[model samples]
Each structure stands twice: as C-alpha cells, then as structure tokens.
Target: MLRTLLKSVSELSTKIDKLIFLCQRSAMGVIDRRTEEMDSDAIHFPLRTHEELRSLEAALDNKKYRDHFVARLRNLMCDDTRKSAKACLQYILSPELANIYTLHGTRSKFGISKYKFYSTVQSALCSHFRSASCPEKEILHAMATASQAFLHDARNKVHKRGWRSKERLASQALSDVTNIINDTSTST
Candidate 1:
C-alpha cells in the first residue's frame, strides 16, 4: 500500500516538473514563434498493424477542435512555428500517443490513450495558453456515449449528419438515448 502511494507521488512530482519546463518554453513563444527545434532524440513508439492505424487515423483526421485552440496547443508544446496541425493530427492518430514525443524536457512517459491525452494535459496547458479550450464536461461524456452507440447502431439518430458542432451533436445523442429509454419503459 505504501509503495503504491510513493509511486503515485513520484509520478505527480515528475509531471509537475515537466509542466514547469513547458511554461518556460511558452514564455519564449511570446517573443518569437517558438521555432526552436525540440530535441530529435524523442523516444519512438512501436508500430501497429495497418488496419489498426487506419481506423485511428480516420478518427483523428475527423477531430474538430476549434482551429485557434489547436494552434495554441501546438505553440505551447514545442517547435511551435515549425509543427503543423496536420502533423500533430497525424502524430495523435497513431497508437503511440502515450509513448510518443513527450514534452520538450524530462523523459517522463504518458500512459493515457489518444482519446484521453488531451483531457489529462488540458488544465495545465490551458493555464499557460489562454486560447486553449476543450468541449464542456457534459459534452465530453455525451461524445463517449455517442462513440459507443456508433459501434452499436451506425444508423442511429446520433450518426445523422447535421450542422451542429461535435459537442452539440454529442450532447443531443445523450438526450436521444434518454428519450429512447423512456419510450421503451413506458411502452412496456
């Protein structure tokens, strides 16, 4: 029990240290585009099968975060002036998200999935990058449900094309699920 607590504390301390270094880089961006190249010695992740990567690629290619938000994140990360959204998008599409290129310094590795990486890093990054924004909490949950329902029913109302933002569509999906549940219960 004590060992687990010690490990957790160690991890937290490492993350805090990384966050400080990232902040230092963020300051430089204000003066220049932060084009300073990050070290190329970043650890690489193992490759997955083509089919596995293709599916993940499709999802990441479909990522719809507001453009300004994405730009700010890239700026704070490293190589702000050099890295492109398409490149970042490609990077995240792979299964190596947790193990891929890390914050500019420190060898700490992340253990979250591609879908979860942003959530874990957001608050810290947001504090430094004022333009950073994520979808609302409820919207994030709804999107998770929608992704699951898409697996169950591609033709479900949640999959219908609409002008709504991704977050709105996700929120609507939750409402749709609730309505269906109520209808079935009342009918029974």
Candidate 2:
C-alpha cells in the first residue's frame, strides 16, 4: 500500500512540474509578443522628408565623419561639455535608440529633419544634464557625433548578419515544434 502511495505521489509531482513549466512558457510568450509589437510600432514611425532620409544615410555611410565627431566628443575638456557628451553618448547607446533607426536600413524615419533631430536631442541632453556652461552648438555636435557612431555600428551589424532577436528566435522555435508535431502525427 505504501509503495502504491509513493508511486502516485511521484506521478502527481511530475504532472505538477509539467503544468508549471507550461504556464511559465505561456506567460513568456505573451511578454515576447507585446515587446515585438512595440518594436514594430517604433520601426514603422514615418519620416518627414526625403532630405531627412538622405541625411541619415550619409551619416551612416561616412566613417570619417563619424570618427571626427567621436574625436571631438573625446576631446571635450569643459565640465559642462563633458556632462553633455556623457548624456548624448548614453542616449545613443541605449536600446531605446533603436527607434531612431529604421529596420529597412541605415535610414531613419524619425519624422524630423536632421537639424530638428539634433535640436531635439540637444534639448533632451540639456534637460537631463543641466549643463549651463556648455555651448548649445557643442551639445548639438556631440549628439550628432554619437548618433553617427551608433548608426555606423548598426550598419556594420547588418553587414555582419548579427544574431537574431529574441522574437525571431521564439517564432522560429514555435514553427519548428509545429512541424515536428505534424510530422509525428502523420507518421503514426
């Protein structure tokens, strides 16, 4: 009787573990779907003009321009200038910055001209860093430099075929599992 009780408990535990695993997987799928939707919205944001597109492309392609801007940022000595540069660099390197780069290529569809983009970025940096001594132009230049470096890096990732995003990997896994299940069902 004890042996039978132990066997039943073992089976019950295995079933509970399987149930918990499935629940966790389902919750993760919901989270992944929501994240993918948000990313899609960002990627599809519209561009304001052809000039803006061209400007973004030029920045992404010009390695010399990007390097020069980065060099200027690195050379900044003023306390205010350093604070502004730090803010600009942090923004550029953030995952949220992906909204500025369209998935189509190095082109951006941020619905703003290059000048406006720089202005907006500078405003954002100033608000975050409160650098009263940094010249506005210097801050703008730092933002532009950081943006160019980010775009250049993104372009290189495309060229090198960077790792697939989590959403893509999850989708592929689901497809493979479906195929396997269908094959097994048909074979049996």
Candidate 2 segments whose C-alpha is farther than 4 A from its true place: 1-118, 124-134, 155-161, 182-188
Best model per TM-score: 2
In angstroms, the error of model 1 at 35 is 9.7
Query: What TM-score, over all chains together, does every model reach?
Result: 0.21, 0.35
Pairs with steric clashes in candidate 1: none
lDDT scores for all predictions?
0.39, 0.48
Model 2 over residues 1-188: C-alpha lDDT tens digits? 99999999999999999997656534433113443221111211123334333333334344444444344434442345445544444433333344355422444354222443344445655554455566666666665665555555544654456645556689999999999999999999
Off by over 4 Å in 1: 1-35, 38-162
Give lDDT: candidate 1, residue 148.
Answer: 33
